[model samples]
Target: MSKILDAFLNENLQNLRDQGLYNEIDAVEGANGPVITINGKQLINLSSNNYLGLATNEELKQVAKDAIDRYGVGAGAVRTINGTMDLHVKLEEKLAEFKGTEAAISYQSGFNCNMAAISAVMDKNDAILSDQLNHASIIDGCRLSKAKIIAYNHSDMEDLRAKAKEAKESGLYNKIMVITDGVFSMDGDIAKLPEIVEIAKEFDLITYVDDAHGSGVTGKGKGTVKHFGLEKEIDFQIGTLSKAIGVVGGYVAGKKNLIDWLKVRSRPFLFSTAVTPGDVAAITRALQMIMDSTELHDKLWENGDYLKAGLKKLGFNIGASETPITPCIIGDEKLTQTFSRRLVEEGVYAKAIVFPTVPKGTGRVRNMPIASHTKEMLDNALAIYEKVGKELGVI
Candidate 1:
């Protein structure tokens, strides 16, 4: 390696470590459920995105096994080539049904979905009105499109309306689109989609919603668009099969023309190999389960409420989260990392989130309470939290 490159790397690494912003990842020993093992130590897990605990569901496991036996593992090629298998087609159909859309298209992952969908539709001649706090993937996608990105304040409807009106009246771009996450994962706040839709209509802007964190947890498992009954109003309904569906892939559900266009124009779909047979089969089944009943969804909310109440009662600064994703706000980065480390030492596994993922100075330990967590687990975790909070002087 060149001396200049080595110096640059070393300087950056030291800076991150000195500022307490370097995140060290720990590997989970077993299934990422309510409890997990790291470094041979058992801890109550509040860090997983497995909102419904469906990742370890026995029935889904069996379904995946059967699919692997029948179709083997890989899809063999890219979609436009020879990789579009029957399982892929079936999953897309199910996605369309679940999102209440005319048709849908699947991608290798949620990040890929954004990268493909955004750039495929928008270009330098267009503009995208994005939320200030939208996910990184959306940001990268907009950049890839070479579109003029206008960021509105996070969930501030008036700001969005003002920006939309400006972009429309200016007539500087041929097409304009408004994009946001259905639920902001970091703060757990639901997007003002109803108000956003109203603004979009006033400005004649296209609407796009990425409901990665809201699919299995909101709108009776239909998602945030359905939460506000905007199924017909929104143009693009994007989501991940990993977070709530307990599988690995992403999709964009919309009108038939859009799906058809993506099939031909989206680079990821044309270039990337399709999702494996087992994962696709399991994703389809998981969507069916979410559609069939609200048992898991209801239980997840119950646990979320329980944990939030416990944390609040203990005097932790739990942010204003509308969904089950909880963040215990600790202002200083070093203290936040220390708080998370102490929790792990005491038998709870909540990870610290700091700069870049969220803004600087608003560091936090984000908790994800799922359906599988019992009263005992929550109570114990709460007890450990109180101890850590007191020791760290965070409460």
Candidate 2:
């Protein structure tokens, strides 16, 4: 390593320390569940994105174990060459059916899926209109595409329409695409896809929805596209298996041709090794669970409502979240960090999100409720919130 590079790293790290932003990683000793063991102590978990709680489901565990027994540990090669297995094909088919699409393609992760799909579609000749608060993967994908990325106000359809109109009238690019998260993970607000579709129709822009947060929580666990009943409207429907599906990988579901094109051209799929058989099997089982029963989904939402009510009752500014991702808004970054540490100390595991992840002044401790949490666990978590919030003057 270069001395200058080492010096830069040290300086940046020191700056983080000075600002009290350099946080130490905490280890979770046992399985990640509704309640977890961290630092050898059991705590009520409110900071996980495991919405359906299938991450620890017995059926998924069995499927994964069975696949491991059969296919062993790793996918030995990239998908373009010889890594395509029976499990891969079946998982893709199941995913396509789940999203109500003709075809689907998988990636190593949701982040990689964004990189693969966007850069494959839009390039130097095309421009992209991205929502102001879209996830970082989308932003990085846009930059890598070498496309002109014009950011529209978050969920502001009027602003998006105006930008789309201007981009179209200019005739500077062959195609214009608009991309947004189906649910803004930061605030849990649902995207106005109906209004978005109208603008896309008017402007003839290709529409993309990254529904990572909406896949297992909305549309009766189908996705945000189904949530809005826009099965045939949105061109690209992206989602992650990691969150609610309780597996690993990401996918793009769309018309047959779009998925076919991605399969051949997306760099990650072309170069990176495919997901292991165990992961593929687990996801397929998780999908079946979502389709066969709505029990977990119902439980997740109930817990969400319960937790949000509790937080609000304790006087925390839980933003306009329409879903389970609740934000206990603490104004200052340092205080937000402090609050998170205190919560962990109090045997709760909510995580703090500060500047650069969210807006500079809107740091918050985000709590995610899952189906696995019982009423008692939620009630206990609420009490911890009350104690921590009052002690920190955040209430």
Candidate 3:
């Protein structure tokens, strides 16, 4: 390696460590579920995106096994080049039905989904009005599009309206789109989609919503667009099969024309190999499960409310989360890291989230309570939180 590159890497590494901003990743010893094993120690897991605990569901596992036996391991090639299997077609059809859209298109992963979808539509001649706190994938996608990105304050409807009006009246761009996450993962707040739709209509801007975190947890498992009854109003609905769907892939559901265009124009779909048959089979089954009943969704909410109440009663600053995601706010970065470490030492696996993922000085330990987490598990985790909070002076 060059000396200059080595020096740059070393200096930045030291800086992050000194500031308590560097993340230390721990490997899970087994399947990521309500409980996890790290370094041979069992801990109640509150750090997963598995909101419905479907990742370990027996029925889905069996479905995936059967698919692998029938279709072999891989998709064999890219979608346009002979990788599009019968299972892939079926998954897309199921996605369209689930999202109540005319058609849908799947991608390798959620990150690639945004990277492909955003750049495929918008360009230097267009503009995108994005929320300040959208996921990093959306930010990168907007950048890749080469579109002029106008950011509005997080969920401030008036700010969005003002910006939309300004961008529209200026007429500097040929097309304009307003994009946001259906549920902001960091703060667990639902987007103001109703108000945003109203603004979009007033300005004649295209609407895009990435409901990665809201798919299995909101709107009776349909998602945030349905939560606000804007299914027909929104132009683009993007989602992940990885998180709530308990599989690995991403998709864009919309009118037939949008899907048709993406099939030809989206770079990821055109270039990348399709998802494996096993994952697709399992994803389709999981979507059906979510559509069939609200048992898992209801249980997830119950656990979320239970954990939030426990944290609040213990005097921890659990932020204003509308979904099953709970974030215990600890202002200082070092202290927040220490709080999380102490929790792990006491057998509760909640991870600290700091700068870059969130703003400086507003560090937190984000918790995800899922349906598979029993009352006993939550009570024990709460006890551990109390001990850690008192010891660390966080409460």
For residue 289, model 2's alpha carbon misses the true position, in angstroms, by 0.9
Off by over 4 Å in 3: none
Deviation from truth (RMSD, Å), model 3: 0.7
In candidate 2, position 345 carries an lDDT of: 89
RMSD of each: 0.7, 1.0, 0.7
lDDT (0 to 1) per candidate = 0.95, 0.92, 0.95
Candidate that beats the other on lDDT, 1 or 2, i.e. the better one = 1
lDDT of 1 by residue, 1-395 (tens): 99999999999999999988999999989898999999999999999999999999999999999999999999999998889999999999999999999999999899999999999999999999999999999999999999999999999999899989899999899999999999999999999999998998888999999999999999998999999999999999999999988878899999999999999999999998999999999999999999999999999999999999999999998888999999999989999999999999999999999998999999999999999999999999999999989988888
- In candidate 2, the residue pairs with backbone N, CA or C atoms under 3 Å apart (3 or more residues apart, or in different chains) clash, namely none
Q: Is candidate 2 or candidate 3 better by lDDT?
A: 3
Minimum summed lDDT over a 10-residue window in model 3 is located at 386-395
